[model samples]
Target: MSLKIKKDLKKIRKYIDKIDIQLLNLISQRARCAKKVAKIKISKDPKTKFYSPDREAQVLRNIIRNNKGPLSNEEISRLFREIMSACLALEFPIKVAYMGPVGTFTQKAVIKHFGKSVISIPVKDVFNTIENKKYNYGVVPLENSTEGIVNNTLDSFIYSKLKICGEVILPIHQNLMIGKKNINKNIEKIYSHQQSFAQCRNWLNNNYPIAKRILVSSNAEASKIVKTESKSAAIAGDIAASYYSLKIIAKNIEDRINNYTRFLILSDKDVGPTGDDKTLLMLSIKNKIGSFYLLIEPFYRYKIEILRIINRPAPETNGVWNYIFFIEIKGHRKSKLLEKILKEVDMRGAEIKILGSYPEQLIRENKSNEE
Candidate 1:
């Protein structure tokens, strides 16, 4: 029986080795193909796009649809995402800018979307890094499931010309982490971002209501502070915890179980279409009795599906309770339906600006990450 078990184990190991060799050869071949694409891109057009969001979306969707394995569809898609990222990097490295202190959730989203091979530039201001022109793209948090939309990111869209090309939904799992300190250490203060504090309010109240809670710009910043302060703890995600070598005293302490944050990928180029796209529009109609109805009536007529509607103060619109509507609707801006909708909106003296058309992301578990 022992001999039989040993023989079987040796046979399985041989098979695994063979499979690894085949995978390596296939990856090398794919890299060669990517090199050919690189040569073609630089042959004439310096403005040629090395990355295509629409194409990548279509590929991942197809991967999910055709996947037949023990692994979940999400797992398969993630593996392919990294494969595509690596292949594309062979052609040209994708430089991405994200609002960060290195270990923020925004940085995780960037890695999840673009993979580890791309150059990730961390900056305090999302505008500065993206506007620098050195980075190929930018990633910023748009909204959170627990909290509402990130107003700063939305406001940035009002003036920034960067187009939203793709999106990533990160499943947030907040942890109570301690750096170089024992978990049993006297906890006097808790450090966390304002949003994270809100998300974990219930848990914090229940666990350490008496502890002084200090709000910081980002959870990453909180994590950094906790590294120096022995009597402090930080509410942060896995990235920060891992980066600072922090031990998690408590896991998934978010008040909401399904905490998720949606991030936007901004780029200079436009994606054609991926069948499933959402266009963002900001509009201000003429202040009148029926202006609001008239402004949105065309969407109903065109059978457009409005996903979300956010109203921001229109300072330009005088003191008539006038507001600007930020709308996310289904379909591309260039589509016939949208073109018709825009014409109707323009005729009504509505100041409408199409922020961008991007691939709509569905619910995804960013918590379950694998190489």
Candidate 2:
């Protein structure tokens, strides 16, 4: 409109263009450096792994610590994560497997943790896929804050040799969505995973009280159902809506505002401690009086903070009443104190299996993804 305003706008645009060029050159330089590092590693050892969880966590933590900006630390981390991901791809493209038909929250966690540069494979069974050497890593749901632990995933760990390498905390935002064909039609039926329905029961009751509710295998399945059906809606997350090209009628319809799901990163490689870590142990004690006390006494004596403990029936036990305990503690398995505690538990007649020791990732990232 004004000549002075137009001149100021032109000046800002010119500076932005220059900065963009500089950024491109710097990124190219970084990519070259990553390639050199990969070559050096290969020369030393042919079986060297390119992805290091402990190193990545340390880098992210350092970035967060030194961040001083108008942009939030989470924003900075997300940007750097993608940049690092791209650079790593230059070294070697990594493959990841997740439970999916596509558009599931687990896939979202894969993208959040590994970035889009990775080759993410959606499979019916993530655990078996990784175990069969079809994929380098896997991401599976561990627990939900509102609904509790995923028993199936926990059960898989009972027999699987995979180790937990990392964790992702995703804030789940369930949405009521409709396909393009049913945008203005009367909502006759709704489809969603049972967990999604349970999470959004109150919102559904308030909004679509008379709609017929149907349960599906997953939120992604619900989205797929709504994609082709007329006068139907799906209660799923943003990824499902985006993947299926559905229109979100209601956003964040979960009953609890703070609903979050924790997903575990599974790999064959074990990770070293990153100072702040959590260890998971599966223990089966002898069916005797004070067995539980014996198993837990070590943790108390060591003053180790117990994060969670779940008791399930041990199928392999000779006694009908024998149980398996999954205990998570706030320390690495390699720690001297934890090692001592493990020995004490073993001496107390408990068969202990150290599941994994991984960096705790409770810090929420504000990336705009599905869950």
Candidate 3:
């Protein structure tokens, strides 16, 4: 508003513009160097083993150690992730598939973990995505804080050949949405995917007991139904609301304030540690006494922390007599303890499959009072 303020603002704008230009130049130079390196590596090795975790980790450490800026370490890490992802794309594009019809929670989770630049292919079912190799990587929801485990997703892993390459936990915020034109009425019907409905069961039962609840294939599909039907409201996430241009009638309808969903990243190739890691495995033992206990005792003996275990009927056998056990543990296959456990399991002659080991999603501690 004043002459001095206006002059100061103009100076700041010029400085910011200069910084932007420097960043652009830096990124362009990096891209060109990466291209040359890729060409040389391809020609020399001919194996096309482009992904190097050690190299990536060194890059991140160098950036963090030398950082002297207003930007925090986390912000710098994210920026480099995008920059490196772009460089990797120049060498070869990464393919990712997730459960969907766009606006579904799985799509949001994939974007959160991989950023917006990834090639995200949507599939009808989680199994189909993994079994058919529809994409290089697949994401499937495994469990939720409020809903326990997604049985179908777990069961799919039992039969699928793909291994767990990584995992990400996404905080879920559910909303009661209605189309713009349908905002006036007390909606007679509500539509949502089964999981969505289950998550908000208590809230819906107490608030809208008389309304007819219809199950749909996905939250995005339910949002579409609501947009087409004036008398229907949909339970979905912010993405669905934005996609359908619906009004949020209510927010955070899940029973728990800290509702989150855990997703498994499936791929055929095994991923090693990214510092933090989680390993998944499926084991089948002979139908003899103490066979199951004998299989899992190695983990405990080796001091490995078991995070999850689920039992499913072996698909190969007709009867439920033989079962398969799925285990998620907090260690990498490269670790000495885990390697020992794997060896012990192998020596026992029990059918063991090392699904894969990958980086564990880091969760920021909640500072919100509501949680």
Candidate 4:
């Protein structure tokens, strides 16, 4: 408006434009370096994996630690992640498969970890897709803070040879949405994924008590159905609402305010440790007195922090109620202490299977708490 203000704005714009050129030059240099690295890897081994989860995790962690910014660490990390993602694409276009029709939480996790530059394929069956080598990586929901572990993921882990390469913790916010035609009409039916239904059970009971709830394969699917249906609403995330052009009737309908869903990045290659790592293992012990105790005693003896342990009914063999234990510990499987503990458990006559070690994503204030 004023001459002085106009002059000051022009000066600021000039500096910003100069900084933009510098940024462009730096990023281009980085991309060239990434391409060179890829060439070297290919020359060394034709089958080398271009994307390294361990290296990426370490780089992100280092970025966060060194960040002294006006922008939050998260914001800075996200900017760097996209830059890295683009550079990696220059190296080799990475393809990832996720449980999706798109707009699902698993897709969101894939994007969050790999960035939008990756080629993320929507697949009805993520496990099979990855196992068949259709995609280099796959993502699936592992557990939720409110609903606990996803049984399907556990079952897949029991049989699938794919390894857990990484993890992403996404804060879930369920919204009640409806199509344009149904916005004014009374919602007679609600659609959502089963886990979403469980997450927002109390909220739905209080707000839409008489509405008939329908379960679908995914929240995205529910949104897709509700987009054309009158007198119907869908419980889904913001992404689904945007994708389907649905209007939100209610936001954050989940009963828990701090709800989070942890998704696992599955791949054929094993990820090396990043010091702060979590290891998952499956164990089958004899169905006898103190068998469980013997299996768990090594963890306590070796001072390993047991993050979680879930017991599932093993296959019914000869009418016996045998159980399998899924245990998550704080240290990586490569650690000597952990190797020693695994040997001890194996020597105790328990069948132990190391699922994988991945960089720890979710940090709890109190490790004992259920989050």
Clashes in model 1: which pairs? none
Instruction: Count clashing residue pairs in model 1.
Output: 0
lDDT of 1 by residue, 1-371 (tens): 69999999999999999999999999899889888988888897877879889988898888788888888887887788899999998888888999978999999999988988888889777666667677889899999999989988887777777788989988888999988864566799999999999999999999999999998988999999998788899999989999888888898999987788999998877788889999999998867789889878899887999899998877663456677889999999999889998998999899888888998874376554521
Tens digit per residue, CA lDDT, model 2, 66-92: 989987777788888899899888888
Shift in Å, residue 89, candidate 2: 1.3
Candidate 4 Cα outliers beyond 4 Å, as residue runs: 183-185, 362-371
User: lDDT of candidate 2?
Assistant: 0.89
Sequence-dependent TM-score of model 2: 0.95
Q: Which whole-number lDDT from 0 to 100 does residue 32 have in model 2?
A: 95
Candidate 1 global TM-score: 0.95
What's each prediction's TM-score? 0.95, 0.95, 0.86, 0.94
What's the true lDDT of residue 6 in model 3?
100
Model 3, 214-309: lDDT tens digits are: 998999999988886788899999988887788889988987777888888777677757666788888888778898888899888867899989
Which candidate number maximizes lDDT?
2
Model 3: C-alpha RMSD to truth?
Answer: 3.3
lDDT of 3 at 230: 89
Ranking by lDDT: 2, 4, 1, 3
Model 4 per-residue lDDT at 197: 98
